[model samples]
Target: MLHYAYGAVKKSMEAYVTRTGSNLLEVPLPFAVKSNDEIVSEFRKALERGKSNGNRVRLNVIDHVTSMPCVVIPVKELIQICREEWVDHVFVDAAHSIGCTDVDMKEIGADFYTSNLHKWFFYPPSIAS
Candidate 1:
């Protein structure tokens, strides 16, 4: 199984960019990040662009603080922000969270998770059951 999942979580972000031509990234630096902070900014920007905070998104998404690759974010804090912001989508990009970190879909409490096994879970190449 993929660690974080496929960039499924980003699917929501894509929607925002498609709907609104705005860029609000928490870590828009050398590389694009998938942190919880980034997720927050994306939603915040969407809301600022005439999007409904209560019903702006039909889904619920959140970013995570990963310690697997020197990445970290307070999941609880993000959740709190979600509740406070009233986001409609909650997707988490956990590509580096498969074997490197123990992730329980239920424990994470995210509406969606984007993880890849090949990245950290030692998944076999093109091996299928």
Candidate 2:
């Protein structure tokens, strides 16, 4: 699995791996990564490292926009990279992007996506889409 550092869904993913006994590799996103290209580069490097170690990246959990650091990730570009790298599945966490950004699921094209409407759409805290 390829996960972003400080990704919102990390806790849930960690629990899943703990139960399944799967190894996880976190792609670090340093503070210097302030642009879309920089963030994508980090993930790309992580994928290459995994491949070099004879490990296939089966799943990638990415963010559309990070909540803490508030970086606008290039979701489509990262998805394309995952495709080229032969990653089996991609789960995009768009919790902070639903109403604030232009998010066309068909265009982004990930295996799965999740967003909390309350964060940007003014719905109840439990609301999600």
**Highest lDDT scorer:** 2
Report the C-alpha lDDT of model 1 over 30-124, residue by residue, as the tens digit: 12456656645644554444343433434443435343334544454554555566655566666555665566677666667766556654677
Clash count for candidate 1 is: 21
TM-score of each candidate structure, all chains considered together: 0.49, 0.87
lDDT of 2 by residue, 45-74 (tens): 888886775878778988887777677788
lDDT of every predicted structure (CA atoms): 0.49, 0.80
TM-score of 2: 0.87
What 10-residue stretch in candidate 2 is worst by lDDT?
A: 1-10
- Model 1 lowest lDDT segment of ten: 23-32
Q: Candidate 2 at residue 51, lDDT?
A: 75
